[model samples]
Target: MNHAWIDGRPGSEPEAVAAAAALIGGSRLPVVTGLATDIAGIRAALGLARIAGAVIDHQASAAIYPAVTAIRDSGMMIGAPAEIRRRADRVLIVGDAFATSPDLPDFLFRHEPDLGKATRGKREIRWLGGPESSADIPGAIEPVVCPADGIADALAMIRAAAAGHRFGEGPIAGEQAEAVAAWMKEAGFGCAIFAVAGMDELAIEMLAGLVFDLNAETRFTSLPLFGPGQAFGAALAATWTTGFPLRVGFGRGFADHDPDLHEAGQLIASGEADLAIHVSGLAGAASPEPEWSGRLPVIAIGGGAASWANPPKIRFDAAMAGRDHDGVLHNERFGSFVPFAATQTGTLPRAADLLAAIAAALGDVTTGAAA
Candidate 1:
């Protein structure tokens, strides 16, 4: 196993673990953010947060807030990626869905006949906002080119048209609105796809409302694109363990979740957190670089070389979750847990192992202090 580091100096794993424990155990306010590891890593992070009285937040929670809020507020009719691939004959993409998942075209417009049962009719792909890019698959139609800020209004017009109501003189032309309404009327199984990143809350709400409205006449559902990381898995784990989503604080001697108040970025920026532990060991996941002028002490455990604008106080090169260690992950396509096997073996320690070591060291420090 490789030696971890404290203040850019190499040290034994035990030394680094004890130093990390001391830093966190003495802090009045500690935060555990950048939760991008697999399920087991998330469980360990939650346990450490409970012991340290820390707050937990994922790095991508800001990007994911729109979808979460939309689903929480008005309720969304959502389908899995596989379900959309199999059954959706008409696809309405609100923004550049390819930005989140580049393989979207292959998933929606693949030529393999044996992949699944083919739709009875030709698949219809339509774009609502932005100029169509070359990434657009064959036979895609763009009826409107609203600015990113205008998507909400455009979707409102579409929803009004779908509901036989008047949205007078909106960004979408009457002819285009009628055409989309006609498609909604004729679509056998329709799906609306959008990337949560770069999307506004109102636009997401409007998109969900549009899908819900279409359900009155035909079968329609929404699919939010999720990339390769533990953001979704971490949210699920937090919900199950703490009965709340991310941005949860344990400082009150219990789990208290407030998306706005306890957000990782907000807390760090406001100098509310004196110490932070960032855990991000998923394969291909990037480490988070929190921006704060307070020069807060940070203990980072993750894969990849550590290169932060403001270097952490303690750093550990942990094993990649699914590639270097085996664990379970939340499958967004099926809304279930799936076993992820280790594809590579190396001397690097897993995040779970490092976290448990830190927790044990912290416990020893507390016991010594009490005695």
Candidate 2:
């Protein structure tokens, strides 16, 4: 299963790796992105980025930015899923809570209550936006139909009410706001949940602020829902390895992080990167390559070959982490690394193996040039 391609034509893996290595090694600036792999694969990609003096980012970083930025600006009181299921008697969800994770209802109703140690009373569920669904959520007293676009204003009103501050009317009525504020204050443990995929930065910030404010009087935490992708794992790997998160560059003989300037989309669109390496090893169809990616040569490695409109210079069908190969991935629910055993013994090479090969070839090119 050494299926590889170069310039839209069938080629050997060695040839493809050699061509990709040459393209990356000769470039003054290279960018590595499409980081949908597990921790092992991301670590290999980061190593290559460091050696190639490239900038690194993830395809889903844009969707993740709001929550990450919110956490960075105002520290978040994060909670685990298990803890929320066991302890959170009240859950305040904003914007289509079940849209991203369909199994959320199951977790909330069937799974959470089955916990033998969870002696808490029935949980209360509330929603802010999104169309109503037929799925029966336990203890759903009433659904608040707040506009999706007006979540920030709604959260601000809630925060102000929680803090006992006088603010003019906004989305939610003053009485409703006061009631919600009082519920949060009285709840033994409350969890504020929001899906970042559908949320704006201001909304996330407002939610975080509300949690922070509520913690003043009672125990409250946030459960920011992220879509199914190992983007969190990628970010965590980058942070632990480089002392910085994604959108980091290593061109100046050291890792430098710039969330705005060095973002993969901006760098590629601005013609700052001469070459790009797109890596994705997780399951599911890959997203289309950025439009600006056509400005430079691209080497793609992963399962997302179907998503690319324009063929890359070199492409390799790599094994999916945790499915075709063993790897470690961050479990956000429990905030731990879960060891995933290989489910299939496929011939497809692991992403780490492919990237390591490219890195070796790149090193040879560098060494030869220096000699």
TM-score for all models, in order of appearance: 0.91, 0.92
Task: List the global CA lDDT of all models.
Answer: 0.80, 0.81
Q: Which candidate is the best by TM-score?
A: 2
**How do the residues 206-268 of candidate 2 rate in per-residue lDDT, one tens digit apiece?**
888888888887788888877767776787788889887788899998999888978988888
lDDT of 1 by residue, 272-314 (tens): 8899898878886655465552368889898543667777789
Any idea how many clashes model 1 has? 0
In order of listing, the candidates' clash counts read 0, 0
As for candidate 1, its clashing pairs are none
Question: Highest lDDT, which number?
Answer: 2
